[model samples]
Target: MNKVAIITGGGSGIGQATALRLAEEKVNIVVVDVNEKGGNETVELVKKLGVDSIFVKADVSKQEEVKNYVKKAVEKFKKVDYFFNNAGISGSGKFYLDTSLEEIDQIVGINLMGALYGARYVAECMLKSGGGSIVNTASSAGVIGQDSVVTYSATKHGIIGLTKSLVAEYAKDGLRVNAIAPGPTETPMVREFYAANPEMKENATGGIPQKRLGTPEEVAELVTFLLTSKAQYINGEVVRIDGGFTNTK
Candidate 1:
C-alpha cells in the first residue's frame, strides 16, 4: 500500500520541496496551504510524478481548519503515514521593542500555534492508524538566539518544545515526532525577508560555515529521510541542518 503524507505550507519552499521528494517515494500527498495557487500547483506537480495528490486550503493557526485538513486527508487517503508540520511566517525583522503587538500575535499564531494545532490533529489521525512519523519546522533561531527575530525565535523554540513533548507522551504509542532547525534557507519566505533586510542576509551568509544559504531541496532531503522508515528509530530529536550557523553562536 502507498503511504500518505500531509504537508502544511506545501504551497512553497521547504514544504513544497518535501512534497516533491516524498512523491518520488510514491507517497500520496495532502498539500495544505492558504495560497490556493501554490497549493494547487504542488498538487499537480506531485500528480505528474505519478503519486495521488490533493490540495487543502487551510490556515493552520485555526484549530478547526487544521482539523478539517486532517479529516480530509483521511477521507481521501485513508491513513496519514507522515506529516510535515511546516507552516510558519518569519516576522518583519525588527527588534522586539520595534515589533508591533499585532505582528507578535500574527507570528505566534501561524508559527507556534499553527504547529501546535497540526501536531494535535495529525498525531491523532496517525495514532489511530497504529503510528506515523512527523517532521516539524524549527529554525536556527529556535535552537539559539538571534537578534531581530525575537518573536519568530520564540515560536520556533516553542516548536522544539512541541516536538519533544509529543514524543514523550506518545512515542510508545507509535508516534515519531521530530523537528528540523534550518539556517538561512533560500525559501521564498526567507528570500522575501532577506530582500527587505539585505544587510542581514550578508551577515547571515558570512556567519554560516558553508558561507552560503541552504537550499529547500537540501532541507527536503533531510525531512524525507527523517519521515521515512529509514528513521524509524529516531524520535524526539531536533536535527539541525544549519551548516554550523548556530554552532558559531
Candidate 2:
C-alpha cells in the first residue's frame, strides 16, 4: 500500500536511511528532526526518489512539539500510516550511580519520553485513519546490561517495555508495535562513542561474532521489515540486530 510515514530523527543515522528506503517503496515521507539542515536535506533526497516528503523540526520529547509534528503531518498528508520514533540523545555517559538527576532526566526525557510522545500523537491519527505500524529504536544496551552510559541503557530498556505494552493495547486496532535493538552500529553517535573510548571501541566490535560494527542501513532494513507486511505476525517483540554480541563470550 502507498502510505504516509513520519520518521523522527530523519536528519541522520538509521532514521535517515529508513526514510530513504521507505520513499523508494513509494511511501510518502514526513521527516521530523531538530536539525533543520539535515532534515531538509533528507526531504530533498526523498523527493529525488520520486516521493513526496516534508521536514518538520521538533524536539520529540516535548508534548507540544510532537503534537505539532503530527498535526502538521496530518494537515499535509491527511493520514499517517507508519511512525518511527527514532530520535534520541545520549546522556552524560557515566555509571548509573554517578549519573546526576539532571542527566537521568535528559536520558529519560529524550530517549524514552520522545518515543512515547511520538507514539501518542501518531497512534491517535492511525486509529482515526486506519491502523498502522510503530517502530521504536532500542539498542543492544536495552537487551543486555551495560556499565558505561548506564542511564542510556536504562532508558532503552524502558523503550522495550513501552513497545510491548503498546503492542498489546493496540493490536486489536491493527496497530503493530515493535522495536529494533541495534548493536554497535556505525552511526555518528556510535562513532563518537567509539572515538572517546578506544578500548571500548575494540571491545564492542571484537566481542561481536561478526568482528565489526553494523551499519545504519542494516538497522534501517530491519525497521522497514517490521513496518511492512513481512513482519505482520511480529508484534510486541524486540528484534536484535547485534551480530551475536549478546551471545558471544
Candidate 3:
C-alpha cells in the first residue's frame, strides 16, 4: 500500500516543499495549515503529482484544532505513516524585554504547544497502526542562542527536547522522532521576518559561513530522508542543515 504522510504548516515554505517531495515518492499527503488557500493549493499540487492528497485547515496552537486535523487525516488515510510537525511563527523581531506579553504567548502557543499537541495525537495513531516516523522543525537558534528572537529561540529549544524525549519513551514501540535545525532559510516566513528587520537579514547572511540563506527544498530533502525508512536508525537526533552556520558559532 502507498504510505500516508501528514504535514502541518503544509501551506508553504518547508512544509509545502516536503509535501511535494513526498508526493514524488507516491506517498499520499494530508496538508494541514491555518491558511486554507495555501493548504488547498498544496493539496492540488500534490494531486497533480499522481498521488492522493487532502487539506486540513487548522490553527496548530489550539489542542482541539490539532486533534481535529489528526482525526481528519486518519479518517481519510486510515493510517499516518509519517508526520512533519512543522507549524510555527517567527514573532515581530524584538528584544525579549521589549516584546509584548501577547507576542510571547502566541509564539509559545503555536511553536511549542502546537508541536507538543501534534506529536501527542499523531504518535498515538501511529503506535496503534504500527511504527511511524516524525520530523520536527527546529531552528539554528534552537540549538544555540541568538538575539532579538528570544521567544522563538526558546520554543525551538523546547522542540529539540520534545524530539529527544519522545524517542526515549517510544523508540522501542516503533516510533522515530527527530528534529531539523535550519539556519535562516529563505522561506516566506523568514522573508517576512527579514523584511521587517532588514538589518538582521544582513547580519544573518554575513554570519553564515555560506554567506547565504538555506532553501526550503534542501531542508525538505533532509526531512523526507528522516521521515522515510532511509533513516530508520536515526532517532532522537537534531540534524542541522545550516551550511556550517551553527558550526561557526
The most accurate candidate by lDDT is 3
Candidate 2 structure quality by residue, lDDT tens digits, 167-240:
78889999999998898888877787667776787877879998888998989898998998888889999999
Report backbone clashes per prediction: 0, 0, 0
Overall local distance difference test of candidate 3: 0.96
Better of 2 and 3 by TM-score: 3
Between 1 and 2, whose lDDT is larger?
Answer: 1
Q: Between 1 and 3, whose lDDT is larger? A: 3
**Which residue pairs show collisions in model 2?**
none
Instruction: Point out the worst 10-residue segment of candidate 3 by lDDT.
Output: 204-213
TM-score of each model, in listed order: 0.99, 0.96, 0.99
Off by over 4 Å in 3: none
lDDT of 1 by residue, 124-197 (tens): 88898798999999999999989999999999999999999999899999999999999999999999999899
